[model samples]
Target: MADNTAAKIEADASEIITSPRVEVGTRGVNRVDTVYASIMDAMSNGEFPESGRLPTETELAQRFGVSRPTVREALSRLRLDGLIASRRGSGSFVLRRPDRNIKRFAPIESLADVQRCFAYRIALESAAAGLAAELRTPRDLDEIARALEHLDRVREQGTLGVDEDLQFHLAIVRASQNIFFVTALEMVGDQMRVAMQLSRSLSLERSKVRREVVQAEHREIVNAIDKGSSVEAAEAMRLHLGNARRRLFEGPQSE
Candidate 1:
């Protein structure tokens, strides 16, 4: 059973970002401003507006009067936060709506938003993975693996694997096939996005070094449910989330 995948919304993240008209901090002046504006505009109207296909790098650059790199950087921020998805050689697309939870955030206060969101999400999603094992389909396995492959690439390349990372989690929830399961997953999507974005500086390899170990745990849970080991599956999920909360939420403070 898989435990990931959020519902899809049709809209472009770039079409609606907002501009504050000034430089913020250590980041570059105009580009960051433009990117942030675009992002905010998009978020202001909701993460994606239904009017257009998710804008391309070139299109965004042209719209903001910045380089494609600037747009890419901005998109990268959204990517880690689970705001956008890209299909190789095709283009990026906005999925879910960025509800008021993310939209109503205060100017300076949004930084911690991600952490809070993830703290909540970890609890919901870890349990979902376990449930999926018993509720998933063979087709679900294929979908989950595809996301996993993308995650592996991000780990190896030592860059943000935001989209892939979210995909993996989303697949798990989808596999669970429980409406409540999926609803729980959506409830935390924005926060999960924030946590993932904030943690981008963390080394994917170093941070996710326990890939095989974590994966082994996943397999246990998966196999348990595949074989109808409900107790085992549920326990596996409990343990998985317990570890994640300790490391991500209550871990030793760093700056």
Candidate 2:
């Protein structure tokens, strides 16, 4: 039985090791970031083996058509995000599989786009959250609560939960009962979706304590809105987004 099991494991590893390479482009984009994103998407799509082991640095570099230094830098970022870990003799391995169901949105091409998206969301969503606090009905509160509940459940499953997060924000906007707020969100729906996905992806890569902190931030906004404190709700929303921005771009220490 032991010999048979060993043979099966070897076979599985061999098959996974020979999987197709993912090539990334270099047109007006950061190569390291593009390589990292490509690897992440490949993993999420089950291109990697169930054993969690990753291809060697040389193999990855060749596959991505970039320099070994570029691949190393990309891998370093993945390590910092806690998505993969290195073993002295065994190479690097993935820690978890990203949610496969995530729909492809407009790719976040650069750090500048990330910064601009967060800034726009902070101004737009905070206002909506504040208005919801002042003008929400029980039904509006219920929608927000349901969305929050969905987010918590998905988090427990260790997924990014982008859809649930977006729904929570949309619920608040709906509660505000202002057509303009809803319209504005819809106008940039694709960008907002990508931003939410990126933020949640980072959150998933961090510690459990960090994840809980994000959830707590969501609850704070909900509680303030429930109490009809527009000022408190707006402040909570602004602070939450600010911290999210810091966590993503400025590092966890900044948050």
Tell me the spans in candidate 1 whose CA falls farther than 4 Å from its real position.
1-115, 204-228, 249-255
Tell me the lDDT of model 1 at 167: 70
Q: Candidate 2 has what TM-score?
A: 0.57
For candidate 2, lDDT tens digit of each residue in 109-207?
Answer: 343355546656677777788789989999999999999899889878989888888888889988989999899877777777777776777666567
Question: Can you give the lDDT of residue 225 in candidate 1?
Answer: 57
Query: Among all windows of ten consecutive residues in candidate 2, which has the lowest summed lDDT?
Result: 100-109
> In each prediction, how many residue pairs overlap at the backbone (N, C-alpha, C within less than 3 A)?
24, 0
Off by over 4 Å in 2: 1-109, 250-255
